[model samples]
Target: MSDQVDVVVIGSGINGLVAAAELAKAGWSVALLERNDLLGGFIATEERTLPGYLHDTYSSWHPLFVSGPAYAALGEDLHRHGLEYRNTDYLVTASVADDGRTTLAYRDPERTAGLFADSRDGEAYLAAVNGFLKIAEPFGALLGSELRSPSTILKGLKLARAAGIGLLRDTVTSGRAYCRREFHGDEVDHLWSPWLLHAGLSPDHAAGGLMIPVLAATMHGFGLPVVAGGSTGLIEAFGKLFAELGVQVHTGTHVERVVVEGGRAVGVVAAGRRIKARRAVLASCTPTALVRDLLPRDAVEARFAERAERFRYGRAAMQIHVALSEPPAWSDALLGRIPLIHLSDGSGSTGIACAQAEAGLLPAKPTVVVGQQHVLDPSRVPRGAAALWLQLQEVPFAPAGDAAGELDTSNGWTRELADAYATRVLDRVAAHAPGLAATIRAVDVVTPVDLAAHNVNAVHGDPYGGAGELDQSFLWRPGPRGTVPGLWHIGASTHPGPGLGGASGHLVAQRLLG
Candidate 1:
């Protein structure tokens, strides 16, 4: 590899890959470096549970990615390079109460409305969907644009013109408040409230009211989709495209520090070698890492450094992957067909779990996101076999105690504790799926501590980068511009928050190229 390049990307997460691809497409020489031997930061698949069963260990869904700007620009090239996505048909998603009742959302809006018990709520549901569709254009633009940019102001003006000033106040309302004001049924609230968890927020969180409608419209517009083969399929395709673009790819190399001289990031020191950057140095890292550990002490002003120091991270999360003998048989048949179902009971259950996690206590009943990959893509496992992807979003990074007082907290996420917690999660699933316990061929549990150890960007096991609170988002995002010149930030920690969407990467590339 050359001693210098036009850009040096410090991480190989989705954002890093997207930024590198876009910059290289614009004819800028780029070098992408990763500490882990793997390329994707949180996207990976493996037979951890049992051989021949491919489980998406981290993030699996791609509705955001397929619908975002990055895909609009690079989808053709990525698809041409062997990135195939498999999606469900009618059943998009659902929520199952503890009593075995289900609330489902279908691709057809009318069909979804039919699931509602009350006729009035059904009509209200349709109206909400229509209202969201009316404003989705401007709202999406605002979410995807740089908050400090003039285009953002124009988008806001367009939204205000379309929806009126009242909508602006609605944007700041909590999710719980939005549900109460819009609909009068528990069914609708139960169905959509759990989705806020994906954004690293609870039902009581600020800006959740704004997210609820968008989340509903997104699911109704684009159903949950996964890679054709496995999560690794998309990353492998990215690797192939990166190779073709002649971007130097370095894996398993630790970047000790970003070299700063004369108040600008000129290069990065990795493995005791200095790789210079002529144009820019992009760090797809948490603010904690970039400001505190990587940059020189005098590179950033003290006030900015203090703000970075106080950058808060949300609660921890864990993953429980199960290889099943056969597909789970749910009491409600609708749940059997849905690709993703929340075993959250309802919004009340979800709220309690989030509260418990934030308080440093292990929730007795965590909202279990039960993902059935085989329902859409059967090739991931053996014939007639199934794989369950369970995401536990409500858990502490460092446990203080268990709310149920059943597990040991003194050890701090040891293997025994993880296994015990995994058992509790399985019990929750078995409540809805009668044969789930019997069908389990193997189980693999990953605790929040395990997650933090896996990726440094996942500070304290916050998988969405950092908390998606209002303060850390929008114009307040740490970068695309940093305190130090020639430095930029892109990743889940920055604008537009988490998920598989490459919006941060796409946005940063546009700015650099301009």
Candidate 2:
């Protein structure tokens, strides 16, 4: 292979794949380099527990990707390359409390609202969602474009004129506060509050109020989708598209540094070889890594480097995959049919767990995201067997103590600690599903340490890139461009934050193409 290309992408994550594929399709020679032996960064499917059980090791849902502009641009190509998705037409998600009370959401917002006990709250819920949809176009434009660009400024102005100052106020309000002010009942709060964790925010965070509506409208519109067979099918499709486009893919090759000359990133040194980039070098990595390790000391100003240094990571996360002899017999039958369910009671419980995690203590009752891929695609498991993708969002990356006061954390995520925590999580699940423990054939626990080891972008076990807090998000996000002319950034750390959505990569690719 030639030691040069039009672009050198320094990671094979979803963002990197999207950028490389888009550019290559536009007739640019792109060389994608990855430090790992695999192409997909966090996107992987494997049978961690037992044979014949395919589990999405990390991120499993694709609602963000399916609804984003990246899919609009590449969905056809990916589908043609053997990508298939399975989605629920009705029941999308639900949340269950410890007392067996359940709140559900469906593809029809009106139907979901109708299920609420207080009729006034139901009306308020519908109104909030409808209000968001009116501004969704302009809001989406700003999110999918460069925040400081002229187009983004115009979009912001359009949104302001359309919604007035209320939009700004809602953007800064906490989800907990929004729920309290808008709805009288706890149903709305129960259903959407725990979702803030998925955006790397606590219920009390500034942007949760806005994010709650976004999540609600997104799920109601797109429904929850999981790639057929396994999440890796999406990656496999991307690989096929890359091959057909003649994009050079170099896995197991570490990019040591960006070779900058005359204040431009001309190439990258990967595995002791110089691979030149004639157009651009897109580093789908954390800002911290880009400033502190990848680029030369003088490549960027000291202030920018310091800002990167201060890029904070949110709470850690853990994944527990369970292979069951039979499906979990949830006490509430509705939960059994739902694709994903949250074991949270909205802001009341979720807030406390977030606080515990932030204090460096393992949440006693962490929010458990129960993902049942087998329900949507039976091919994931054997004939009658099932699997559970249990995700723990409120976890301490380096626990100082256990909130339950039952596990020792002095050694930091030791196997014993992880196992104990896993038991705690399973016990919580068992409370709702009495027969859960008996049906578990095997369980595999992935700690925060494991997550950090698997993906470099998962800095300190923060899977959603860096913290999605107000200060480091939106216009303040790191970059699609640096001081260096040809250097660019994408991935979870960049604007539009983290998700399966390839927005950041698509945005940067469009800019380069333009």
Candidate 3:
């Protein structure tokens, strides 16, 4: 196994697979390694309770598919490999009250505004949609995009100008406080903050608050689309493309360490076997995981070590997947047909998300984002049934008071916590779909522990490798002057930051070959 090759890529996550496929397509002999039976890190699928039902493990929606001249270079590869997308129109924002669920935002933003037009503030909140888009339109143009310098702002500006008047000015100020001030009810704030989280922003945070308008603006332009199969299908599709291109993909094998000589990565030792590479070794993981664990600690910089020790990473969510006997009955016919619905509970959904990530405790009400993928593609569930996913933000990863954020999943009550959260989510679903609780033929739970156990790449179930902070992006990521020549990274944890778009993978490929 220590034989020479062009490149050795550790981890079979989407970015790693895509990078490997691109390298192989470019005529380089590449080998992709994974520790689990599955190939995707967050992109895998499962059928936990029942035999036939399929559930997306992590990501189910991707509207901002990476497309541009950079991706266009792949040519027929994209279409031929079954990489397809479909859109839907459904946004459900509810306010849980003693009376009943007051759906703040139902059909579209206009319809939602109409619901909010009771007072002057409410009417203003509703009417602000158009004015909000004034800013959102330009931000959408940069989705999963490459950063441009001041000289290149014209490219982005040209796209915004194409959107029409007023949109650019809206971009100048994100309507966080504006929406809060205008909307008389907290429901309106709940309605918009989830959109901000979709953009990798925290709802309560300032810079993050601006993301709501941007998310709404992006979705307003491009519909939220789910792939027909499961999220794993995306990874499998990439793997199939790799197979056709003759890339070597080996699963269930984890690389123990990188064989570095004179500060240059030359090979890898995995499963007690050594495999040498001729050109480079790329890690589809966080820099801390790669350098501290795999390389000689003496070679790493003191600053990187210090940052790794203190950088915050409290984000961890548990997913509850249920296969129901019948589709949950929602009073809103529109929500039943939409692909994604956000359940705010009581507190601002975005606030709970950010707070839990910092405090590391379950939010009292627990903000959740629920997805019924079957709404868009019925094939995920069995005939005459629905596949549902409930994601909660409050599940703790490691013990809160631990010296460094270390999560020991070996504990007992973690599952108890997951069970409690899962029941509440299921109850919420039961309200929407009567008899859903009784019809739970099969139920599967993915704890932060299970996720990390599956692949250390996810590091405590933080599927997102690094903090998706504004400061730690673009060339500043892993610091572009190449940590080591012939070495690179492109994944959820990398620049252009997380989620379905293949921007980072495409960038890494272009960076190496371009």
Candidate 4:
């Protein structure tokens, strides 16, 4: 049987959902297809550990989505469809050093600055945030718009006018260099460096010069937010919105190929049936998937196909969900209040861990992102129990050796290996939160291998989709145009890199609507 739609969106991730919703609202008939029995890709929640204890299976934070252009356009509409956010006011985020010294950033600039030992560092942090805000509009423009779009040039001009050539000069500078120059002491650096890991980058990576300050400014501006229930709340709202708009959502149906006729994506073969797209086809998939597996060999030029083949995915990552009997007894009183805390000494420690992971070694002391969701929304856990959302962004998908030289890497991410690594990570957390080991009810570990199995687009368990390196980002995001005429790429693998921003989807929808 054959069916027709104005647009056929493959993969019901954030990007795909955004595109489908936007198009459907704009008077287009859309079909949202997914391979899994459920939608939302990694943006899902489940009782992974125990009944009644909800956990975000993958991405739990909503900083990017809350502040992104897609949210700006769809936020009101989504909120009307049963979407709710549980956010913090003063105690936003904090980082703990190996020495047990904690660096905290709050919603208020003055309050956050006061946490630094050196008063000058506090002043410096505030100044840096203000300085970035001066050029944030244009900077956000560059990030939000397509690299090849004329608006990018206009935004570039606005940025140059606001910040001067000095801003452009730092494009090649590493994040570590930028942080060192901006802040006076390790306290400020320690607080923001590990955040680079979220952007699929390390402290030493290029473009940190811009990202480091921008991230700080953004956090201060729009403190981290989470769905009231879990990450699933956001997608579930989208599902409701889609249904109201009459969008045909086909879950558990895989698109075997993006059929191309006359050098354009005409339709897709899914469920052993050809579903024709009357307008455009948007793929929220990896460049490799779109170019090699889906599209015809001649759909794109040979050169473009070669570039897709060479598309590099960033380091592997893992998520560990810990069901606690009660709230952790943090060593620091201030840390217990903060919702999100990083158990790392800042740039120095995270840099070493990234280096080790890149060298195919399990980082002996990996950076552990301890997300205490129960701090803000008590609904996630039952009664007094707390849920811990631990994220390890720096890990090797296929380990060649262990940095601590204790684990057996010969088996490569086996169940035993994943459990051992989770134990090590939990030990790190236990150092900061005494008696954490005893309070644990259950542990669910999603290793790099497991991440790949869950979402093939992750490509070797890279949650960010692909590398956010200077060359691979912006204009060079696997090239400016899609492989086929009527085909479009709107996912983390595309420009603007990863995260829940959904920038790529918003951009494609705007173009198509225009």
What is the C-alpha lDDT profile of model 1 across 126-235, one tens digit per residue? Answer: 88788889988887788778887776788889878987875767668888888888787877789888998998889998878778878888898888989998989989
- Supply candidate 3's per-residue lDDT for 283: 78
Q: What number of clashing residue pairs does each candidate have, in the order they appear?
A: 0, 0, 8, 0
Models, CA RMSD each = 1.2, 0.8, 5.1, 1.3
lDDT of each candidate versus the true structure? 0.88, 0.92, 0.63, 0.88
Q: How does candidate 2 fare on TM-score?
A: 0.99
| The 10-residue segment with the lowest total lDDT in model 1 | 473-482
- List TM-scores for all candidates, in order: 0.98, 0.99, 0.82, 0.98
Q: Write the per-residue lDDT of candidate 4 for residues 140-217, one digit (tens) a residue.
A: 888878778676888878778998877765677777888787677787778888988988889899888778778888
Instruction: Tell me the TM-score of model 3.
Output: 0.82
Candidate 2, position 222, lDDT = 90
Model 2 scores worst on lDDT over the 10 consecutive residues at 148-157
Candidate 2 backbone collisions, by pair: none
Better candidate by lDDT, 1 or 3: 1
Scored by Cα lDDT, where does model 4 land? 0.88
The sequence of per-residue lDDT tens digits that candidate 3 reaches over residues 172-284 is 33335645544566655656665555554455444443455545545555566666677665675676788788777788888888887787778888888888888877777
Q: Of the candidates shown, which would achieve the greatest TM-score relative to the real structure? A: 2
